[model samples]
Target: MPPTATPESSFSETAVFGDPVAQQLLPLTNGRFAIQTVHGFAIYDEADLMTVAQSIPVEPPGWPNSTLSASAEHLVWRDKNGRLFVQRLADEATLDEAILLEVPGNPNGWDHPSFHLSPQGNFGWLFDGEAYSDEPPVVTLYRLQDGAELVQFRGGLPQFTSDEAFFVRDTAEGLLIYDTTRLTEPLYTVPRDEEISIWDIDLTADWLQITKYLRAEKRPFVELRDVATGELLHTHVMADDETRVTPSPDGQSLAVTFKQDDGADSPTVVAAGVRLYTVSGELRHEFLAPQISPVPIPSACAGVWTSRRSDPVYSLVSVDFAPDGRSLNVTYNDYVATPVTHLYATDSGEKLAEFTGHESLFVANGRSFISLSTDGLVQQWDTATPDATPQTIARYGTPITDLALSNNGELAALVNETGAELRRTADGELIQQYAGATAVTFDPDDQTIVLGFVDGRIQWRSLADDSLLSEMSDYAAPIRRLAYWPNQPEPTVLALAENDCRVTRWQLATGRQLEPLHTILTFDEYGDVIQMSIDDFTLSPTGNLLAGRSWFMYGFGVWDLSNDSNILTELEDQPLGVRDLAFSADGRLLATGEAWPLGGWVGPERGGLRLWQIDEDNVSLRWSTELDQFVGAVAFSNNSSLLAVGYSSGDVTLVNTHLEQFVGRLETVSGVTGLAFAADGRLLAATTRDGLTHIWQTGSP
Candidate 1:
């Protein structure tokens, strides 16, 4: 046995749960799984469970149709308007891979989209599903390399070869194979043995392996003929009553796993010894179903409690070779999808690891096999090259309701039923727990975390030891925002009152409480204080100026810190209440952004971000950039050169502050909850409403 290979000493993350209603395992590639939900498609990395590589929204352009197919790189969908969409996933800050093309057929009534793209991304095949059943199927081929539409012909079951593509179909004359690369040309026709059905046939690159189904003859027989000339190479007579032939793409090898009746009272799927043969019909190797099987295969989340029968029942789901031709992989499922996967040496037929309960076995270009268990455990086994013990990557539990990443990007706090857990983001290692925390934030130094509970209590814990540093009595309400001055010493914390008014200040070290502070207050004709809804407010980097909504003022403000004076500023002119605010690293530029309430959508023209220049004499509006969609979050890059704006459209727009222009945009699978710039300012992290934290790289300004 070889030691396991690891990219790190240990790594773990939570993957997002698929929509139980209409969840599907999208094609896996390079350790990434694209999950198709009812609303859209999401790509998840093996680690970092909810991390979305890219998400394709199914709304205006594409909806009311079915998901054609999806993989890590490509997503194909059809809309009601007879439009087929092909989206290429990307990390770039732009939507460059979205392609909307009108498919030339019935739009609304098709049962499925018959489209397939090769793994190498060089060619594509599509057939109109509606026309296929009603009339002759019209197949169209496209050259992916140049985006050129090839010839159209009538065929089914298209398979790609080395340099040519071929399709098989049943005709009056036996099974006919046509080279799609050359339209209107027939490659070969199988020689019939007394009019056998041509509907099911297997065509490899160099061999057309056709199994003759004779009802009188209990077991079917297969013939190997040249794919191009129809010349008979050899014949293989299956030993059992039933068999399935799986041929490799190269056409040089074939695997036949058999099932036969043992003349018992109850039939069992046993004696399924798989045989491997070369194109010349010589037996290369043989593998028997192992008798010493685990009670419940690892392929299933839970095992069935059926009492063991006297005779063991076994079956093979699939068999294929490793890309390098050194090893082979075989999946043995009892009856349903749960399977026990056996990896064996191709030349010697020696058993390796027996993986249980593995479904959706995907082999990547790296020679590593990725298995997803029914229990949602994602494991990556790199039998290709091993060095250490293999490890389980993640369990991919239900999506976290809320999440927060430390400003230093070192810790990610996930919300659960009990409370919140702070885990090391680097390796998903749990570091501390904040029980019953409703709101959380880290101090400027990132060493101490301040947690607010539902009962209005505030707690501080040291990150190094997970020890209680300080605990204070309840506030009027659960804390909303915890603001700290960048350069202030002895660390004073300002929190929004439970009712969303008045800022209460406290000392963290001694848990000493202080008097509440108010900047501006309005009075009615009765001389009573007026109440207002305050959504956002932020303290300046120097802890002097403030931009928020209070009782009388709702926009930008510079409060008198020493006396708590309610002096109004230019912000009094703005009518819309501020939704979010941020101060630049230099403290000279204050940015405020807001999104209008449109229920759940980031409706167009509903919100935008405004940049303000703060100076000693007066505060003036620099430029207000209009956002075409609903704003989700806004944050200024540390250098104040760029601002990251997240939207309800599941996209983040990067605007250059100095130029006041849209630089680029990044797409997400779900709406954003908050946006924060890493301390280094090179990376921007955005947390989605679905509890996924996406960290994006924004290069130098």
Candidate 2:
């Protein structure tokens, strides 16, 4: 099937940073510039002032980059709130005035706004259109004015699914929405005839760009398009192992970065690099840095940091770019107790600052340190100097079982050796402590804390005074996990009990059981109940379903409680010794991790993930991939398109569900024990058996 052609803006050629070649130098406007870093957006004002736009927390399984674009009057970005944010980038502006326009019907995936900005300062968003049935592809157009939405135009584009995104452009006829999903269908009236799969699309002022790779090809090619109409855009075929692409703010240049590969699926064998091109599709310059060998820290390595203080002896792994595009800030490779690397001038590759002895720093309004010491302390540091001096903000000297941070950064709840503690973020002060607590979380209001204990009890405590408000009980064994449905008003708790492999729901403030306890205790060959997933379990975001594994059966099952006759459908052909399960936020997909013996041998050898899409009565097994070592956990991105698999071998792989292809892979700490996504969908936190947490920056989409 070929993608259909639509009338809208599109992008094709892209430039990327860290492309294993060398740092690139792009001429900036007024000698000041902006760069899209790994996580957030960065800008350097004309005065050489550097500022980070926003630090969105990564959502687990995984969340894609928030749709971001800048116009003459505002910079628009999607936050974890599942809403659109329009911030006035004009100097001296506050986010308070950054209007947040809610999407009608509360669309899922926090689907970023897809619109076009007119030179006259007018912008339009493609809203959820009216689906009257048997429609082709249609999207409603809503123009932005005075922080509100106005009906601009409608029914000029092809019909598309709500999950699909599109771009708009103004032409002689009117506004048009060009859908890229048509790429999966047959090309009828479309322009270009390349049969490549697209990873993403970007639109420039004069041209539309697409990042695509042909079937069985090593690297993706860049295709360009005309802005006012669906015209053939130029194409740039790339070499294998290409990594990143960036278009200049003025839409005149494209920077690309790629790494050389010795073999397939091998760690890139070169230094970070770059390439540049003009809007006319002409190669301008190529830069290559001296390749620095990766120094493997002791397998005792605890974590990686971008702003940490240590002896200047170890390598670090950090990527920060100067706003002027004249320099790049990089930390050495992540190593045991490494220090923060320095910012090097892109032109001369000269060091600007050497942050020694400081723990890794997370920069916000000001610099803050972050450390994972052996003593169970999670600390923050200043990035300016090597003063390894640390400030102990929070310490969990005991073994930790489970933890959760609220949607807002106001609370931290965790089950440690001393039990569950609800800590206030203001001063890292212990707000409340509960004994034998298995999991803790903050309610939607951020005023109440729900603590689930091993004794099959759940308590809701007021955050202000630590007073117990309500308690729900009636479980068979120790509760292993607790989760709440998103945006629900009442306090409904989903409890997972390991002893009997049960999933139960209880309503707070009312001693009522919302539903009967569901379990994986299905009858075996002899009609005897077999307990499964006594070790771990995961609940869908809506709390209407639960996914877990059976230890001996080596399979994962989904328990659906929305119907009269609740059913637990076990995924077919799952390997034995299944460990964990994760569902997308929408509960449309399920990802499972399992460990099994290879070559029909005895001990656990191979494992990976199996993904399933939920239909009405039957489930569609989408794809399955095998791994080298045991898979500890699996998570789906908020969009349900990508799955993050954490392996016991300290490796993480991101896979696209639709294409069933690998997106990227990275190394983590020791065997992963727990994996969580932050509310912002920007950072993924993985807790390993080594008692360390590794946070990875999911670069901008």
Q: How close is each model in CA RMSD to the real structure?
A: 19.0, 19.7
Best by lDDT: 1
**Tens-place lDDT digits, model 2, residues 215-252:** 76556787665644657646676656456565553445
Q: How accurate is candidate 1 locally (lDDT)?
A: 0.58
Report the error of model 1 at residue 205, Å: 4.4
Candidate topping TM-score: 1
Local accuracy of candidate 1 as per-residue lDDT tens digits, 1-701: 00112211111222222222223455454456665543666666765544576666665432224453323444556543345655554556244444523454334233335566654445666776542255666667776544578767665545554335555656555566777666566677655566354334775556677777666665667777777777888777766543777676666677777665577686765566678877566888877765534332112112211213323645555786655556677877664334677777766777766777665555544456655655455566777543335557545432333445567766666653345767765555666766667667677778887777756788888887778888887554455556664555677777664444456678888877677655333324357544343434677666776666542223445554554444435443463435567778777887776655333332223566778788764678888855434565678777777777776545667777776677666655555567777666655666664445665655533
Where does candidate 2 stray beyond 4 Å?
1-400, 409-412, 421-433, 486-489, 521-535, 598-604, 697-701
Candidate 2 accuracy as TM-score: 0.41
Which consecutive 10 residues in model 2 have the weakest lDDT in total? Answer: 16-25
lDDT of 2: 0.51
Clashes of each: 14, 69
Cα-based lDDT for every prediction: 0.58, 0.51
